[model samples]
Target: MVTDLQERSDQINSSDQNKIIIKEISIESEDQNQKKIKESKRLFNEGSALNNQNKYQEAIVCLDKAISINNQYDFAWNNKDNQLLNIIIQDMHYIIRINTKKQFYVMTKLYLLILNMIPIGLIRSNKGILQYN
Candidate 1:
């Protein structure tokens, strides 16, 4: 009868060990998910700052990384959309200013000045509006 009791106790212990292992795995996975989310938020905020500075390509890259890390990041998506709209508006302003005769040279010089302020290695032609390289 002692042998029979020992066999039953060993089976119970094995099951308990499996439960502990499963719980540990679950906790580790949760920690990794939290880290990814935190990184995503950081990237999104950086992208927004870059966007404000008119570094469109760099900003898009950062925002895309944030979205890839966390597909449910709505703020990143919104900011990306806003950046695109700002680019469009910039282009429109260029085209409108180009059509004016007296202000064309002045606007072109102003545009060049603004472009020079951007740190990115992009150039825009006076007639090309917001085209970037």
Candidate 2:
């Protein structure tokens, strides 16, 4: 009977030790998560500073790093998207400036093509009647 009681006590002690180990592991996991969050935030701040300085590409890189560390980082994603949009808008403006005449010519050709697709009967209808099908 004494041996049985001792065995039960040993089992309870081991179970308690297992619970302590699990708690320690849980604490370590939380610490690691907190560290990642801190690092991601730092990267985001750096990216924001770069963006404010008009260094869009560098800012995007920093934001990407932040997102890689924490995919759920909404601010980094938004800032990266904004940087890409700014680059696209800048490129569009440059293209427009360089190809103004070419764009106008293309638009005119498109308009003429559309006009030619209309039926002559409708275009020259009597009483100014016009219909499209």
Q: How close is candidate 1 to the true structure, as a TM-score?
A: 0.66
Q: Estimate each model's TM-score.
A: 0.66, 0.70
The local distance difference test score of each candidate is 0.77, 0.77
Q: Clashing pairs in model 2?
A: none
Kindly report which residue stretches of model 2 are placed more than 4 angstroms away from their true locations once superposed: 102-133
Model 1 agreement with the true structure over 29-102: per-residue lDDT tens digits: 99999999999999998998898789977888898899888877777776776676577557657766777664
lDDT of 2 by residue, 3-49 (tens): 99999999999999999999999999999999999999999999999
Candidate 2: RMSD over Cα atoms? 15.6
| Candidate 2 steric clashes | 0
Instruction: Tell me the lDDT of model 1 at 78.
Output: 66
- Position 116, candidate 2: lDDT: 62
